[model samples]
Target: MSKILIVEDEDAIRRVLKKVLSEENEKFVIDEAADGVDAVAKIKINNYDLVICDIKMPKKDGIEVLNFIKKFNQEINVIMISGHGDLKTAVEAMRTGAFDYIEKPPDLNNLLTSVRGALKAKVVKSGIKKNKSSTKKGKYEIVGESKKISDLKDLIVKIAPTNAKVLILGPNGSGKELVARQIHLNSLRSDGPFIEVNCAAIPSELIESELFGHLKGSFTSAHKDRTGKFEAANNGTLFLDEIGDMSLSAQSKVLRAIQENKIQKVGSEKDIYVDTRVIAATNKNVKKLIESNIFREDLYHRISVIELNVPKLDDRKEDIPDLISFFINLISAQYDKKNITINEKAIKKLSSFDWPGNVRELRNVVERLLILTESDQITDKDIVKFSGK
Candidate 1:
């Protein structure tokens, strides 16, 4: 259970926040404080996983409370509640160590999503060890025992200790990011930050700035000096997902960084040397892209020092049952539902189909079934009605 403290001077708002959280998930053990002074007192005595604090408060303000927490326990995530007038202060509070901020009369959806994300990140930041033998799994835990998965696990164990760059190839939703995360979590540099960038998501024009950062007035929207992924990931791991989608110009810059462990800001001549481990992943066939002149061959060679291919669901269907069981437990906890049982016929039916979207699709189907099905047991009919496969 996650212990959350709702700190608000307003009685009604505090009550509403507690109500929303408790209704969303009973597992949230919530406490309340009327003002920042009480909040600081409670925080001093209580171990809270999250704090929902209003930006404007009596006695002590949210910023002061946030500073206290940052100094007291950096692990505790604070979500600032902001009114219209407090927006600027809220942003500053975020820079001051707030996890996220929600506007007044909080959009419940955004509030809940932020809460979940903050809690999830808290787990990752806390560096909790995964129980390899248990069904209760971390988001990045590799959950399978098939020959291919077994071999993949073995390879990760072998390569994780080295500073070798890895190129992970797989279909979309095949858990490529999970593999990248596992590599970082088990590596010698596990204590450092793990920064991830989706090359495909950013525009080609901004990709360079996104990776290498920019100085004040570097571009039209470059308001101030910004740190890029390469710099942020210094002395850690930088995961470049969908490298196949990266532009040739950006690819050349990436190659330079990989070859020389140095990067330049977009509007600066100064070189910043960093000891960052690069891990790249792509769903596309990189070699074909190379032949088509879309991806750089030299960059490819540098990143492919250790190649790891995450198998698609069809290639590892034998692991579906295990995956299903794992997801059931995972999604159940996320939704605050009791663990539901899946019949053999349901599991068999699920395994029979080719999951075009791979493990990701399967998890969605499981979540769907858990929500749509009325009974505690999930069967083939539930699969038929909800799986959408």
Candidate 2:
């Protein structure tokens, strides 16, 4: 369900908005305000998913309300309703952080579409914020007791307090992200945001905008101004996952951002300064990439101030029993099932198989076995059948 606010001076318009929105979606909880002053008061007192306000209102206009809400709660989406003559003001409203602008004498479809889009965008932004917060809850706590794990934790504790860049080397699914989060959690800028960008996931053509942002009208499809991860993570950490997959051109820009704590958005000449700690992780050998000239050596040197290597699941076989127990408890809770036990024979069999997908693969196998096994105690037979042994 989405909570929405309708701020308009005219009673008829306000009532019409409420009726249209309510009829469109029963889940929408719509609130009305006579003007900007009333809207601001309501905004402060309540949490709303979207706010639609008329540009010309008595006492406090929509622009004032937009500015106040942006300063207080940037997460809340706003849509400005303006008269045909207020087109200039509407554009200004967008510049001042309104999600979008709609001409007055509202078309039902246009109003509904803009509101729906704003709500969907709010949901995505909220999800990202939640994910970031959840990732930060225990940035330093390494969840293992093995000697290798303990040593890594100790190293992280010692190195995390510095502004030094860290290069985390590990195999796929080896918890490299966990290591990166630990460094950020323990760093001097722990309170600041920790933004993550997957270099491999972003297309090479769009990687620049993803990192440094883009100006309005910077390129085709750039309908409005956008902030990049670098700007968003100012005074914080930016974790670049799969850095080895980043293109040569993107690597140069990354190098510049590290060398000088400044970046120029695509199609913009002005440099935006950011105080960000860069932590990069890769499953591939960066040195080999440099040797092949696919990855820039200078950038590698800039980001590799300190390097931490996470061992693969095979190398950490001693931790298998503990890992199995941990997964069983975690999976059981998540699936709403009672905890299952792993027999000694099953443990031995698991230890023997080479986990090509590392810890993630192990977790999946555990969940599968838990679902398929008839007995509460998992044995070698269950492992063999499920694991394709």
Candidate 3:
């Protein structure tokens, strides 16, 4: 059941909100508080999913309560209740971290809608956070018995036990990230956090603040203090995916962190020491980038103490059958469908195709086949039709 707190000084309003929410959703356990002080006290003890707070109250106001929630539990959604006079204050409450505001004499429909949306968002963010923490053994398990795979597994074992930084090189979707995770899982920091950052996905301006945190009020949108990836992955592994696409400025900050074992947050001067293992990956060329003056040669040398390469899917066609079987079982369970069998002819057709998108691409094709196939078994015609280049 989801817990919610209703903070209003007026007893009638608080009682009405409690009744409305309870009638709307019997699962929501709503708690009422007459003042901000009582509200903060209850919040300290209970893990409330959502908080509906009034702006005006005796002793401690909604702004103070909102600020308190932002500092202690940033995930909790707080919705402000504003009177006609409190409209401007409600707008300010948003900047201070309240999720959204509803004008006083709350509209039942609008209130329910905001509450439902906030609770849904909370569930999604919570699920994503937990999904990031996977078991050590299963997450990095590589399938197949081909010579190329065997050689790669052997290389992983050799480097997994070391503290040296590793740089993975490969074509797009060729399992460079799996190699990085395997190294982390096999290393001494297996029990610690395995934080993965896609350098290419982050915007150029905010990359620094992303890797190293920023303080509240550091910028226009920095309403609350945030923790960065480096700090999050302390005493653990930090996987920098697509390092080739990172900005030159961000690269220099990363170099300092790797070299000195310390990082400074974007708006702070204090250097924080982080005992993190760096594993960087990219499909771009270090030599060409260095020659072009886009990438720093010194940083490349710092990150590439142990270099490893992942082969393309087309180069490992012998493993396609095992990969197909693995995907059938995994995808069937995920989608709640029966696992389909593929004949030798179908396997040959899949193996014959040039998988330019590599292992990642193969998985997508398998999922598509699983969802679209008419029969209980997969065939060459299915492969030909669904496995489009």
Top lDDT hit:
1
Residue range 143-223, candidate 2, lDDT tens digits:
566777777776675455445567999999888998988888855567799999999999999999999999999999788
| Colliding residue pairs in candidate 3 | none
Tens-digit lDDT track of model 1 for 1-389? 99999999988888888999999999899999999999999999999999999988879999999999999998888888988677557656755667667778886765786687678757755774323331222468998999999888877765564456789999999999999998888765677899999999999999999999999998999999999999999868999999999999999999988766779999999988877889999999988998999988878867886788899999999999999999999899888887678999999999999899999999999999999999989999998988887
Clashes of each: 0, 0, 0
Candidate 3's residue-wise lDDT over 1-389, tens digit each? Answer: 88999999999999989999999889999999999999999999999999999999989999999999989987788889988677557656755656657767886765775677568656744654322123234756777778887777776754554456778999998888888888888665777899999999999999999999999889888999889999999878999999999999999999989756679987899988887779999999988999998899878877776678888888889999999998899899888886578888988888888898999999999999889888988898998888774
Error of 1 at 310 (Å): 1.0
* TM-score for each of the candidates: 0.65, 0.63, 0.64
**For candidate 3, what is the TM-score?**
0.64
Candidate 1, which segments miss by more than 4 Å at Cα? Answer: 1-138
What is the alpha-carbon lDDT of model 2 when measured against the actual structure? Answer: 0.82
Candidate 2 accuracy as TM-score: 0.63
Candidate closer to the true structure by lDDT (higher is better), 1 or 3: 1
Report, for every candidate in turn, its global Cα lDDT versus the true structure.
0.85, 0.82, 0.83
Winner by TM-score: 1
List residue ranges in candidate 2 displaced over 4 A: 1-141
> How does candidate 3 score on lDDT?
0.83
